[model samples]
Target: EPEVTQTPSHQVTQMGQEVILRCVPISNHLYFYWYRQILGQKVEFLVSFYNNEISEKSEIFDDQFSVERPDGSNFTLKIRSTKLEDSAMYFCANRLRLATDTQYFGPGTRLTVL
Candidate 1:
């Protein structure tokens, strides 16, 4: 089966710096979402995108964070200013609008903010 892929499997960045994480899709999907899991914490929803715009976003997705689909293929999440709490494994998930409503996730990009 096809899947989503994230780049820079591991990333280390200093606090107050900017970082851009990318997600690429290898198969067809209707809805895309971004999620993060802090150290030892539950997977949290960050944002969801559809029709090339943000459909919904959680409180954690503040001004410091932004999402976009540049080049009409890959999705990207930009953190304008990183903080220590920003460190987590960022995952890219998508849904095929099937009957079961299952979500497929990427391997994830680990972001470590100092």
Candidate 2:
């Protein structure tokens, strides 16, 4: 089955450096989203992208955070000046364009900021 792909399944970064997380959503899906799960916590929506632009984003996705779909394939999320609190499992998901479609989640990428 076709599924979203996330690279660097685990990333370790310094507190003040920038980190870019990458994903390739299911090709047939029309909407892409990013979500974060703090260890043992509920998953929180980060941002949603469609038509090559941001459709929605949470308060947590501030100026320091950005998303892009470079080359019309891979979707990327960049976090500038990582903070300890930013360490979490980030998941990439996609949903079909159909009105009642369900979102399929990709294997999460674990981010650890030291």
Candidate 3:
């Protein structure tokens, strides 16, 4: 299993500011990547990146966020309009091979919106 590393391990911004968080996954694991945000006691799915397929998003995929894979191994999650409530530990994670496999997570990026 390969590990995913998220850069800038932590970020802070004023409410309404824009922030971009990055994820770097191993090449072979490029089949896809998904993101979820963990805040307090809840884990909510955010988005999924498919190499050549239509991306999937959750209800929380509201207008304030955007995602892009700048290259083969890196994925970026952008918060176009950060709110105080958007502050949380955002994780880039997904199951590698099968459903039975435990989901792997990147070093979560802590986003703090002031």
Best by the TM-score measure: 2
Where model 1 places Cα greater than 4 Å from the true spot, the runs are 98-100
lDDT of each: 0.91, 0.93, 0.76
Which residue ranges in model 3 land beyond 4 Å of their true spot? 52-54, 95-102
**Per-candidate alpha-carbon RMSD to the true structure:** 1.3, 0.8, 2.2
Which is the winner by TM-score between candidate 1 and candidate 3? 1
Q: Against the true structure, candidate 2 has what lDDT?
A: 0.93
TM-score per candidate, chains pooled: 0.94, 0.96, 0.84
Q: lDDT (0-100) at residue 112 of candidate 3?
A: 87
Question: Which ranges in model 2 have alpha carbons more than 4 Å from their true place?
Answer: none
Q: Give the worst 10-residue stretch by lDDT in candidate 1.
A: 94-103
Q: Is candidate 2 or 3 superior in TM-score?
A: 2
Per-residue lDDT tens digits for candidate 3, residues 1-114, read 568889889898999889999888765664455555656566777877676453688888888888877765687888998988888888887556554756678888998889
TM-score quality measure for candidate 2? 0.96
lDDT of 1 by residue, 1-114 (tens): 788999989999999999999999656687889999998999999999987999999999999999998988898999999999999999999887674778889999999988
Candidate 3 residue 45 C-alpha distance from true site, Å: 0.6
Tens-place lDDT digits, model 2, residues 16-89: 99999999888867788999999999999999999999999999999999999887888889998999999999
Lowest-lDDT window of 10 residues in candidate 3? 27-36
